[model samples]
Target: MMKTLICNMTTYMPKGYSTTPVLFYLIISSRHLEDIPLQAKKCRNSKVELVIVSNPEFIQELLPSAQRTALLYHLSYLCLAKFPKLERILRERATETQLLFGSSEALLLKCAATSQNLVSTLLPSLKAAVEKNKSVLAIKSLEKARVWINEIVDKVEQMVKRYDKHNHSVASCTSDVLNEKAETEKQIEQASKEVDALEKAVIGLNQELWNNNQEIGRIEATIARKNNELQNHIRESSNKNNGLSFMVCLIPFVGPLIKSIHQAQANQALAVKTQAISNELSQLSNEKSNLKNKEWNIHVRLTDMQLKLATMKLEKGSIPDPVHLNDVQTCLTRIQQILIQIKKFWEAVSIMLEALKDETFADEHFIDDCEMKETFLKTITTAQKHWRSFGEYCLSARGIFSLQTKDAYNFLETSPSSLSKEEWKRQYDAVIVKLNKICPEVCTPKETAAIA
Candidate 1:
């Protein structure tokens, strides 16, 4: 609902009328200003000035008379103004003809009008004024509507700006993610190239390893044959010494003339054979020592390579890849097992050498004199210790080989042609050296003593 106060300027006094009469105004109510129609009959006799007072508070000011007079129409209020002040003024002017004339006028008007008769006098002028006010209100409503439309436009613009901001943020995030993905792909490609190069190197190494293994096998065979020969020579030399000792003792008891002739011939043959066996034993021993040194050097090299390979693997990453994790674990397990076996074998070698020391003392001739027995026992003990040490070295070599094998297997499974042949050969030689050192007696001959 809207409210406004309107003034009517058309109502006025006539030129001959000698009355200080203010125009009478009526408060009109309607649903809207435009809905109220002009009424010429309602205005003519009533001398009413119609002013639209939409503000309910101002309507009371227009009707200040003490008596409340009401005339009703369908959903409308028509008011006629009356007051005691105006009545007393009219009564004191006691002009009988004028009073009779006013009375006659009132009666004639009452007789002439029907109960529904409306004075149409106020319609033409009042309608025009109301129409003007309606136009003003219409223009005001249009202005407000324009302001509302502008506010909606502003809200829509803000919404568009916010959408653009969010879209930009999303685009930036996508670009960053794409860049990161590209970088990761580049890293993976680089890693793959390195792996390819490493594979080629490993392949060459493996071929070399095969050649070295063959060489080591041949060497082992040679050593075994040489050892067998040395063993046979040692046994023969020992028997010859015993025979000569027997000869010397027998000759001392026999007649000197006959004994000298027989003894000289027998001793000459025994000495020559003993000297040959002695030289062979010395040669074998020297070769054994040389081989042991070589083997030790190879072991050192192999260990260094293993350490390097392990470092490379560690450098790769902490999180085990799904592809390699299982292989790595299996290799580690085998390495552990090989180490355990090596340790057990080393202990067994120690125990066997200790038992062999006892066996060497079973010779009654060597253990006859207390000083000689002590000396012999010391020699045998030393020899056994050396042998045990050599066996231990072989065990160490075997353990290293197992670990290297694991590494090789890992490489081969992933890429067959990795290490160079020369590299593999070097590793293989190293393994052989360690093996030879671990069991020096197995690779060399025990020396034979020559009897004079």
Candidate 2:
């Protein structure tokens, strides 16, 4: 029946739960009251909850005197899970039977079991039980020690196998970690060298960029200077062309005026020559009048001499002398020839004066009015001033003047007659060309009119 009960309790026990409390309960109910006191002693030392013991008298009857004392002593030390009514009954029974009444075993068990350290409870109980029944307690102790020794041996074997497996895995993991660390160090070294090379290349490129910028600046300045020179050349060429154009337009109008001036000069020269001839003729007339007066005085003297000789002859009653009469005749013939030469010279002088007066009047009538003359002179003066100024400017700017221009200016300063008509015209054209080369504005019609 006890075997069947143990089997049924083990079968019905919950999985994964502790078997110590169940085994303790089964021991209290079994016919083995010898170990009941030891089991109760163990349960009092550790955390084990026990059911209330039934059939206390039956358990008491089964135990010998020494075990009975030990069981009552252990029961007195129960705490944590208590059955008050059952505990009271067990105490009363123990007192009446004198099993633990006033004994040191009962007193020492109570003191030890109630201590904070439970190991203090074990020695006292074992000593008391051994004193009471040495052979029985010794046999039971040896059996319990053998069973605990077998359990410890099995657990140690299992721990050794688990430790070996864990050590093997840790060694393989450590080797893999070391290999990975070596590869990472090699890659880091290569990356640092590449970074250094790139830095040097960047520095070289920056210096090249700076040099290129300086060269570009110099090129820009040179281009600007060349552009200024080109602009000046173009402006000078344009001015020269304009001046030539103006001179071409003016040549026709100036030609007739110049011809008139030359003709007027020629007429003035003729008038001067005519006045000289008239003065010479007046001197000749004065000389002829004086000679006539001398001839008349001679005629009067001859008449008076004839009258005197006739008077003397009448008084003397003789004819006049023949030598006196011959002298008088010679004087008369010389007077007549001198008078005819004077008359012929006066007639020639009158005809020459009349012809000169006609030619002078015609020349004066053909000349322009005073205002026109003034305007023409002013135009020439202003053109001369402008031409002179331009010539000076060209000399200052270019360091020299054209030979044609210098020669033209020198010719203009001299007498117009020094050059022939065609030669004068050529010099005038040369001056115009020079003026065009220097400044075109002075040759414009508006400027010419303003000067006039």
Candidate 3:
């Protein structure tokens, strides 16, 4: 039995069966031959000559269900086993279409995981399928594919920009590190130069220190030498000063001893001379005492002569005067004795006083001062000569006067009465007055009282 290709043919058939030949032809031509099949026994037994003719709608008809089913089967097999490359393309196209027509969840999931190769291979096919389908669903699927393609391309561009930015940042950081290293090397070189200069200065300072040490050593040596010399000089001076002090201590006693010994010898010789002078002075003192007594006696004799003269004046009126040789001779002898005693007394007194003066200044060295002692002796000699001469002359003159007056008086008394008694007495009185007037004083003499 042969099966018809179309199901439910009766529903699609015209209202009534067509009686016109054209109508039957039209109906048969609208359908595909594969929709039905003839049985073998029918083909063998029938000799029916049915001519198949072309209808206008034959080539432009719907595909039969059987052929459509067969085509779908072939495509599924190709996709699963025979045509892997094509199948991959178709699946990618299908996923793209689904992103457009299916849901937002499917498109979002595909965008996160889709590669560039998947998008490029599938998008064009998906666009072609939409154009061929020419339906609202197909157009929606095409728009979804376009949106995903744009989103992926934009993301890729952003990633490329980010990679470029990262490369630029690394280059900048590398350049900075290199500059820092170069600057550090320059600073190290400068520091090395400074250290070398300081080292040279330190060497110069060390040399100067050595020279200063040498100068100090020389100064120390000079000071040591000077100190030694000064010590020697001080020692020598101390010794000489000690010797001079010893000599000074000995001089006083030695000088006085030698001088005193010489003076004692000279004093011994002077002592003998002084003793002889003392003996002479003793004799002269004795004579001076005797002479003093004789001078008193002479004073008494003068007093007696004055009395006699005064008595003669009183007796001048009665007695007569005469010159006699024997009476003159006796009076002269008495006057001579008194005068000689006076002269001797004065000479002895002078010599004794001189000896006493010499004994008073009896220093051993007195004669060494010759000028003063010679002047003292000259004065003493002049005084002594004047005294001696005056005494001797006075004595001789008194003797002459006494002898002349006595001779005149005796002659007057013994003469023959040649003159009157009164005249004789007057002459005797005048002569006695003359005798008293001519005599030097033996006692203190009387001076005339000028007022009286």
lDDT, residue 105, candidate 3: 24
| TM-score for candidate 2 | 0.16
- Please list the residue runs of candidate 3 whose C-alpha ends up more than 4 Å from where it truly belongs after superposition: 1-347, 350-364, 370-378, 381-385, 388-452
The residue-by-residue lDDT of candidate 3 on 45-77, one tens digit each, is 322111111111111111121112112222221
Which 10 consecutive positions of candidate 1 have the poorest summed lDDT? 71-80
Q: Is candidate 1 or 2 superior in TM-score?
A: 1
Whole-model lDDT values for every prediction: 0.29, 0.28, 0.29
For candidate 1, lDDT tens digit of each residue in 247-298? 2111111112112223445456544553554455445445544544454345
The global Cα lDDT (0 to 1) of model 3 is 0.29
* Position 84, candidate 2: lDDT: 34
lDDT of 2 by residue, 1-452 (tens): 11101101111112211111111112122222223223222233322222211111111111122222222122121210122332343333333223212231222222222221212222233233334433344334334433432343343334334334432432333333345435434544333444445445545544554554444344333433432332232223223332211221111122222223323443455434433433332343333334333433443333334334333332332322222223222322222222222222222222212222222112332123444233323333333333233223323322211221222122213343344547644644443333223311111111111111
Stretches off by above 4 angstroms in model 2 are 1-125, 190-452
Stretches of model 1 off by over 4 angstroms after superposition: 1-191, 240-452
Query: Alpha carbon lDDT of residue 240, candidate 3?
Result: 32
State, as a TM-score between 0 and 1, how close model 1 is to the true structure: 0.26
Error of 1 at 241 (Å): 4.4
